[model samples]
Structure formats: C-alpha cells, structure tokens
Target: MLFDLPDDAVLYTALLARDAAWEGRAYVGVTSTGVFCRMTCPARKPKRENCRFHETVAGCLEAGFRPCRRCHPLACGSGAEPSVAPLVAALEADPARRWSEDDVVARGFDPSTVRRAFKRQFGITFLEMARLRRLRESAGVLAKGGKVIEAQLDAGYDSPAAFRAAFAKLLGQAPAKFAEDALLRADWIDTPLGAMVAVSDRSALHLLEFSDRPALPSSLRHLLKASKGSLGLGRYAPTDQVEAELGAFFAGQNATFRTPLALEGSEFTRTVWQALVAIPAGETRAYADIAREIGRPSAVRAVARANGANRIALVVPCHRVIGSDGALTGYGGGLWRKRNLIELERGYARA
Candidate 1:
C-alpha cells in the first residue's frame, strides 16, 4: 500500500522517483557498469531496459553483477557492531569458554552491540547462541563417532547433566541416545539460503528440511516414527552434497541437486510430493492442479494437507505450490519468504 501497487510496479515507480522508502525491497542493476545499486543509489540512472531490478543481493550476483562499493549492498544494520560477521566464525571455532564482555572488547566490539546483533538476527543472545551452536556440534559427534562423554566436553559443558539437559531441550534426545544404526540420522548442513537439517539412512534421505521450517518438529516427529528412527544432529551422504548444490541454486547459477532421497509418505502423499518436485524452478502450481496430477482430482484439500506435511522446502519444492487462484498460500516460512523464493527462482527465468 506504500504506493498502491504490486511490488514490481511500486518498484518501477520508486525507481522513477528515486524513492528512499523502497531501499531494501528492490535493487537496480545497470548492465553498463556491471554493478547493481540499492534503490536509493544516487548513480545516474540508465535506460529502463538497461536497469533490471532484483529482489536480493544474491540475485544481482547471480545475474553476474558485482556489488557496488558505494552501495555496499551486502551490509546490514542490526545492533551488531559494524565489524562482526567474523564473530560467528570465531564462535564456530571455539564455543565452549565463557565469552566475556572483556573478551568482546578485545575483539574490538561493543559487547552490548554483539548481544543485540545475535539476538536480532538469531532470536538468541550471543552466549545462548554459542551454547546452542556448540551443543549442535556435540550432537553431531554423538550421532557419528559413537561417543557421549567426549561430545559433552566438546560442546563446552563442564557437567554432563548440563549437556544432557541442553541436548534434550533442543533435540528430543539426549546425546547418549544418539544411535548409529537407526533407520534415520539427523544432521545439519549449511546452504546459501541458510542452515538445513537432513535426516537420512544408509540408502536414502528420508527427511531433508530446513532447520527453520516452523513445521520441522512436527515433520520430524511423524517421519521419525515412520522410519523407526531417533532424531539428533548429525550428517550423512548427500547432505553435504545438497548443501553445495543449494548454494549454487541460490546463487542462481544452476539447479544441480543430485542427492538421492528416501521419500517417506503414504501412496497419495508420495504422489503429491513427487509432483511438487516436478514443478520447475521459477514456476508455481495450483493446489487443485497438484490434486489433479496425482489422479485424485477431487482431493485438492488432501493434496494441500500433504503439501503442509512436506519436510523439504526448496528441495522437495513445496514453495512452488500456490492456491487454486494463484495466490500464495500459508507457507511455514511465511508468505513473504515464499514470494521471495519465487522471485529468486525467476531471476534466471527463460521463456
């Protein structure tokens, strides 16, 4: 409603007026400079045909445009210090020790800013986030190496009880409960989009869902029972591979997911999910069409339910499923993200 128009149209008008309100939502790429600028960029405007709009920095990069040094498209302003991306890296390397305000000052950062940044972005304070990150690492250790006590120490917990409680809180299982022989092994993989959790057995990936999917816990609970397996943090075949391929996918380079997955669902559910995968990138499908594709034309309601049950997001491609009237439906990640996903995919769109 800012300009009483659709996003693209509003963006076009904003571009025409060089509006400041539309800064983050839109970017303009000039083919001449081979660079992309923020909506508020003061650079001389090029011809409308020469100025292509993008939804994100990733989109501009994918389109082979470098970020303009003047615009600094990748920068974000949370309460975090202007120089704190490396803190995440440092915490990844050593998360056990109590990181004090003095320690943060030593790193040339305001500790409060650090705390706020972590909280704003991750919804958790820096110390709590470090604890969680370390705990996740410990879960991986127990899942694969068959060691519990070692995992506890590796997670930076001095007391085993503390580690066990944290593990139980995050994953329903204690570290000691992690089994190597279960039908499924849950693990974490980082992609360009974000961190994802993949559950797999020796043969196939039964569950490949993003860590942030609101339906993840429910999906895992259902899938775990179905697979006769326990869930914990760990990694397996194709999780790493999928992570790499997804990075490429997000960069708009190519869709190169070759990981074989163990699809889990009822016969009808399986059909709906398979059809979901068949949906090409940058395109969308109606719920009724999905039902029709499964040969259950009247099962649109059932198909939509199955779509909600889908574990994988971008991979299994549930984001492509829309309403019968082509409206975005209730996505677990929120409809705005669904819209962003569609636009991200359409960046490389071809006729």
Candidate 2:
C-alpha cells in the first residue's frame, strides 16, 4: 500500500506551516535549490511554483534533487525513532557479529524496548535483522561454491545446528540440500531498496521477494514443492531479464517489465493479477476498484487476498494497490518500500 498525497496547493500550505503530520509522509523538492526537505524542515521555505512535492526520498533523488543539508530528510524515517538509531549504527559497524538479547542488555538498553522500537520502525526485530544480514552473507559464500562449514563461520555461527536452523528458517532448506544442477534456480538480485531473491526456470520467473521478508521461507517451500525439489542456486534466463528490468525501473529509465512470469495461482487470482498489471505505474487502485475492474464488483476482499498471495513482487505491481481510504495498508515488502515505489512511479508519470 502507498500513501496518497494531497494536491499541490494543500501540500504547499502544509509546507508553509512546517506541519509535523507530514514529516515522513510528504516531502517538498525545491526546484530552485535542487534539494528536497521534510515538511518540518526549519530552513526557509521556497516559493509555491518552485516547490515540488513527493511522497518519498527515492522520488526526490530520481528527480535530480539532493537531500537538504539542514533538514537531512533521508534520516527522518530510519533515525526518527531514537531508540532504533544507535542499534542500527552498531549493526552497520559490525554486521557479521552474532547479536543476542544479552548483548542488547549489556549496551544499557532494554531488550523488549529495542525489539518494539525496531518492529515499529522497520517491521522486524533488531535480532531478526542481524540474523538476516548474517544469513545473506552465508548464502553468498555458498553461492560461490564455499563449504557449509566455511559459510557457517562466515556468518559468525559457532554451532552447526544453530547455523542450520537459522538458515532453514530463512530459506526453508539447509545449504547442503541445494543440488548442483537443477531445473529451477534461485539467485540474489540487489535493488535500490534491498536484496531480493529471484527463483526462475529457463523461461519464466517463479518468485521474486525481498530476502528479509518473513514469508520468504514458506514461499520457497511452496515453490520447491511445486518444482518437485528441482531448486538450486543459480540464475536462469528469466532471472537475468528481471534483474535488468528491475535495475532500469529503479534507475527511472523504464517502468515497463517484459520478463515472462510463471504465475502459480487459481483462475481468480490470475485474473486479479491481470487487473493489477493494467494499472498505470503512477496510479493506484483500491481493493474495490480492482474488484470492479476484474468484473467482480463485490469481491473486494477476495481481490485483496489474491494481492497478498502474489509471489512476483514489482513485476506484478501489487504495491499499486491501497486501502479504500487512500491509506497505505499492509505490504509484505514493508510500508517504507511501498511508499518509495509509489513515489518513484510518479517520475514515470511525469516522463
């Protein structure tokens, strides 16, 4: 789900008032200065015509505007939660360290408080974030033909069983289970937002999701079952195509994705996906709107369920769906990413 911003006139008024309500939801890019700032920035305001409002920092950057030095608009989302900032910094400082609840307590912070803060801001606990980072590193080593023991050490896991459990939690299988030659392959694709895991066969992409998504393990399990355990580590033709298209999309070069997709769902779900693709990049549709468009005007909830069940991420454009009230609802990729995607597409509309 994405935040629907008000018209420019109303947004300008909010900017003039330095409204705190719009601090993270809306930003104004100053055309004259070539910079973007949060609504609560204390710097002098620009004239109405010279101001351009966007819903995300990615939008500002795509439009060729640098972050304002005074406001530091980029930090408003990640650093706004005071309790989460220091922990994020520490994680960045030593990403490979095996973090634990005891370590948080030793840092003079309550473990529960830290957990809640991280969950509220990033949609994951601090320890979960650390574990995901370590696992991703380990996955990289395995992808490059490294041994399981080497990968475990690289991820900073002292116990083999602990490492296997953690890896299985994220991937739904142990590192050793992946075959050297398989029909369907999985690979990592880095994007502007984060790293995404892409699973594909020779002709079509089966799955594309953020590596840290909680639902990833279940999704992988389902995919493996469907593929009859013919899943391994490597890219297929579809993976390469999607990687390029995603790169272009984030770079603001092209919004269209032509990669072939192997959609695995019921007829109704597939219909919903078609309706989603018909939506223009810069616009959004509510569940009711999608239902009506799909010729099932009363199936709003069903449409929402199908949207959630979608496996291929941006290529299917599930992020283009929002609540009926224009509020961003639940997005599997995280609300922060949903906002960025919605705002980033506005550049496509302008182009």
Best by TM-score: 2
Error of 1 at 50 (Å): 33
Q: What is the TM-score of each candidate against the true structure?
A: 0.62, 0.70
Model 1 regions lying over 4 Å from their true place = 1-94, 97-128, 143-146, 227-236, 324-327, 334-337
The TM-score measured for candidate 1 stands at: 0.62
lDDT top scorer: 2
Question: Each model's RMSD to truth, in Å?
Answer: 10.4, 9.3
**Residue-level error in angstroms, candidate 2, position 256:** 0.5
Alpha carbon deviation, residue 194, candidate 1 (Å): 1.8
Task: Give the Å error, residue 153, model 1.
Answer: 3.3
